[model samples]
Target: MVDTRIPHLPNEILYEIAGYVDDEDILNLRLSAKVFEYITNDRFATTFFGDRAYELSPEGLEALVKITEHSVFAPHIRTVVIGHGGKHSSAKYHDLLDQAFRNLAAHGNAISIGL
Candidate 1:
């Protein structure tokens, strides 16, 4: 009897199977199994973190900080898009923006910023 369970497959075969799927499908595969997630970690980091857009809100900036600090995801970031909905007049917003930029500078992986 052929054991055809997904986890029974070798990493190379799983990787090849993952290569044929779209981004959304890949995400689903990752969620479906730990082995899939482990094999696709590099691809996931590159595909998702290669370019990201965030609103210029406290939460968005905080998320950006978290990503920059991530050892695995940081190196994959190539571009960051900052969406300023409108002019932010609050000092707190400015402070957050400043801090976020500082973190990005330290990360030094994101080479492009789209405003």
Candidate 2:
């Protein structure tokens, strides 16, 4: 049973939780409710998105593409780094990198390629 004594989470609390995790988790949580989506998009919460978030959701990808294609992030994104964590960094990784490059290129506003 739910405990009534535990106060409902304030927006700040939700925002903090969302902010602490990476984009993938945020995307999952965003689907949980409208409140959660608001929390992650709150001014303070958005600061947590990492520089290169992979294993990404289409939602996250769309948002990130919007952000980086602008002048604010355009100059900073000189390279796109694509690789599986740890031991998987081989031809498979290269192929993934190529796919990512193709995606980015089709999007075409990323400005520079790095990998």
Candidate 3:
């Protein structure tokens, strides 16, 4: 039988490494283990959303709003980068953007929205 255990890593080390990983990889890491779940969370908002501001979509915006719904995860988001330029500017996209901002505003954390 093959050993499938992951090496133990400090949270600080994991967080540092996370900065270089893309959103998909970071989200995947969050689901790998309890420790990684903790590690990925420390920078979830910034790493996942901030790094992919240009590629934001309605689905992505919805996901971001869902995370900010949590009190623990909400404060990690200090800056929100919203890209208004999209090839398809549909009503659905606008609705998602509005909802995302409203959700963030409800947190009352004074987040700065970047373009």
Worst 10 residues of 2 by lDDT: 42-51
lDDT of each: 0.80, 0.49, 0.65
Deviation in Å, model 2, residue 25 alpha carbon: 1.9
C-alpha root-mean-square deviation, each candidate? 2.7, 9.8, 6.2
lDDT of 2 by residue, 46-101 (tens): 34422355433344344555545543333344354433345343453454444445
Q: By TM-score, who's the top model here?
A: 1
Ranking of all candidate structures by their TM-score, best first: 1, 3, 2
Reference-based TM-score, model 3: 0.48
Cα lDDT tens digits for candidate 3, 29-112: 777677777766656765544333433666667776676677666655677676657555546577677766677678776777
Off by over 4 Å in 2: 1-8, 42-115
Please tell me which model should have the higher lDDT, number 1 or number 3.
1
Model 1 reaches what TM-score against the true structure? 0.77
Task: Give the candidates in order of lDDT, highest first.
Answer: 1, 3, 2
Looking at candidate 1, the ten consecutive residues that score lowest on lDDT are 87-96
Q: For candidate 1, lDDT tens digit of each residue in 1-115? A: 8777999998889999989879867789899988988888889998888998888777887888888777777878888888877865446577666766676677675468898
* Better lDDT candidate (2, 3): 3
> What lDDT, from 0 to 1, does candidate 1 have?
0.80
Q: Which pairs of residues have clashing backbones in candidate 2?
A: 79-114, 80-114
After superposing candidate 3 on the true structure, give the runs of residues whose Cα lies further than 4 Å from its correct spot: 1-56, 84-86, 90-92
